[model samples]
Target: MRPFAYERAATAEDALRRHAAGDGAVAYLGGGTNLVDLMRLGVAMPARLVDVARLPYDRIEHRADGGLVIGAAVRNSDLAADLGVRADHPLLSQALLSGASGQIRNQATVGGNLLQRTRCPYFQDISKACNKRDPGSGCPAIEGDHENLAILDHSPECVATHPSDMAVALAALDARVRVRQPDGEDVVPLERLYRSPGDDPSRDTTLAPGDLITGVEVPAPLRMPARYRKVRERASFAFALVSVAAALDVSGGSVRDCRIALGGVAPRPWRAHRAEDALRGRPATPGSFRAAAEAELAAADPLPGNAYKVPLAVNLVAAVLTDLAGEAS
Candidate 1:
């Protein structure tokens, strides 16, 4: 790993002030699960690191208004175990549990997971041409083994999947990321936080240079019967091939409201808005789930090797819907 300067920020403002001093070459150090690994691999060579681990983990706080406030520094393990989060936002907890090993989870932070980089093989190796890794460089994955890459929101310049299970659930829950900037702080809708890789793959997140995620506010009491269904090559410590985060509000065996998000198939945690629209007011049955899944995958643009992901995404969404319906019973 390249030698880099490090500092511990006592407050959010201090972190920003120190970070701006280094300009874009500085990176906020969260749990150091992904970032540290990248630094060792020479994929990320940030000249300086601002330690945000000591700041504060506001935690998953249940509000009287039936919302959830999750602090940025909260550990993944802690977020998964929060009683209110576990009960109200089951999908979020489930997604967290479906991620990396316990050791990694114990250190990974909420904000860091949301901001994790893509897992594209080529992008990780500095030797290969990856637009996401370096601008003006080509993307080799387009002609390579893109089976595990992306099937949604992919551009010719880049086709890498955003590998965060927590992000998928957050997208489904319509959670907002609270970010603090030089002027002030504001909440950005989770869906808007990520951008599709269209020519400029280097810009992964929507957060400006100096912006730091403070915490995430989820307007919860999550329309009940939510689950995160993940499909992978193995049962443990592996990324999903096609994962689905689904929440359903069922009344008398019928869907009153629904929200669905897909991961491992896109550049970001994708909100299947059309599918949710189709499922609302419809019976929470396999037929309706199938139809909704169909509606969502219709616009999916799959590459040559990733066409299988289209069907896998559809099936996983339907299965999760079935699971949610069963739980409602």
Candidate 2:
């Protein structure tokens, strides 16, 4: 086993200091949901751990701007049960409920969920050839059991999808992520936080290694009707096969505005740009939904085993829009 140093921070600033002094080789400790497992598997060999567990950023607050303010360390379980958040943003509550079990939810943090590694088996096994784990190593999933992997926004180097159900909901709401870099703290729009894996799959996020997510700010809801739909192999304990989050407001039987995002079939929580573009200022009908889903999926690049996801996701998008349109509430 590789040896490492551990330092606990008294404040948020101290955590940043420990991370920067190590030249970005430091890992910020969250609820240890994914990180602890990676360390045991030898997938991550950080030289130091900056434990930010003691920081006072674990509370979930509602902003006066009519938005949700989730601290970086807020537990998944707590976030899911917050009355205000659930009543206003059902998409978020639904995502959290669909994630891991109750025990795991109590231990996972929103900040860590945003930064969790891919669920690709090859990437977790060091002996296997995985581009995401070792930059130059060829991707084994290119010819392996990629049925459970990504089908959209994939490049030659990688097809691993981001694995957070909550993230998909957040993306649809156009949330903002706060990061405490080695130098200072700043906020980044959620849509730009993840990068597509082109030739380099080893780099997973835009967060420089030492940078830690400090909090997430969900903007005020557009007052448009919104909902989330998730389908999985199991009802209670599984990741989505094809999930969708949407916010729509129809004016005079036409779509005046909409926000769409997809999960479980993309490199990131895919903001359906094609669908979003196709949806705005159009008639709210099943035909238009089909056209929109097809337009967005046109750019998807699927692997040999996961091609079925394309049609599955397309159908799901159409169904979700139809259900949401029929709802009177």
Give the TM-score of each candidate: 0.97, 0.96
**Each prediction's whole-model lDDT (CA):** 0.90, 0.86
After superposition, candidate 1 runs with Cα above 4 Å error: none
lDDT of 2: 0.86
lDDT tens readout by residue for model 2, 1-329 = 47889899888878777887887567988889899889889898888988876588898878887798799889999999999888888889988888989998999989888988998889889889888888888888988878889988778888898888999999999999999876688899897899889888888788776677889999886687778888788877877777898888777888888888999987789999889999889899989988999999998778778888899888998888878777723
- Give lDDT tens digits, candidate 1, residues 78-187: 99988888777788899999999999999999989999998899989988999998888899999997888888788999999999999999998889999999999989
Q: Highest lDDT among the candidates is held by which one? A: 1
Find the candidate with the highest TM-score and give its number: 1
Clashing pairs in 2: none
